[model samples]
Target: MTPIERKLRIFVVEDEALVAMLMEDILLDLGHEVSAIASRLHQACEIAQAGAFDLAILDVNLDGKPSYPIAKTLRERGIPFAFATGYGGMGLEQPFTDVPTLAKPYVSEDVQRLIMGLMPSIP
Candidate 1:
């Protein structure tokens, strides 16, 4: 069966509204339910804690604030996630060194593949 058929739930945290919309569209098209999308680190953390998402797509920087706190919370909850950034490998902080990342301007298929590979049955 296609990965989407499993119906994973994902949360998106991106500072750019347009990018968030595009990511949302891609996730929706993949047949997964988007639990929430937020632009600020505060809002993102709130949603991430409140929502029962299986995974998350985190933007390393939200405005000038780093998303490490949110990423830490996800890690504590045992939720799988990947960084999606425009900064390439230079964007990651030491804490996120081992997590998967996808550079921006990426193909939608990459998002789908990463999600499917990391969280086949939802976390």
Candidate 2:
């Protein structure tokens, strides 16, 4: 069997409506379900702490606020995640510099690649 299930539940932390919609469409086409979408830092953090999902796609910034706190929460929960950013590597800092980053204005392929990378190892 594959390393990942046929369907995954993902949480999205993006402030842009259009971008979130695009991501949702891409994930849906990839046979994944979006458990929740948070547009604010506080909301995202709360969900990160209490939400039930396999992975998360966190935008590097949310309304000028960094999404690192939410990312930290996900890490504490042992959930895998990728940072979505337009600034590329320059936008990341310590602790998250090595995490997979999904560049902005992404296509379905880019998102799919990140999702595949986040899959749990079978071995």
> Which ten contiguous residues of candidate 2 have the minimum total lDDT?
1-10
**Candidate 2 local Cα displacement, residue 27, angstroms:** 0.5
lDDT of 1 at 92: 84
Clashing pairs in 1: none
The number of clashing residue pairs in model 2 is 0
| Tens-digit per-residue lDDT, 47-121, candidate 1 | 877778889999988999989999999988888888998888665888788888878987778887788778753
- Scored by lDDT, model 1 comes in at 0.85
At residue 83, what lDDT does model 2 achieve? 97
- In order, the Cα lDDT scores of the candidates are 0.85, 0.89
Candidate 2 residue-wise lDDT at 103: 90
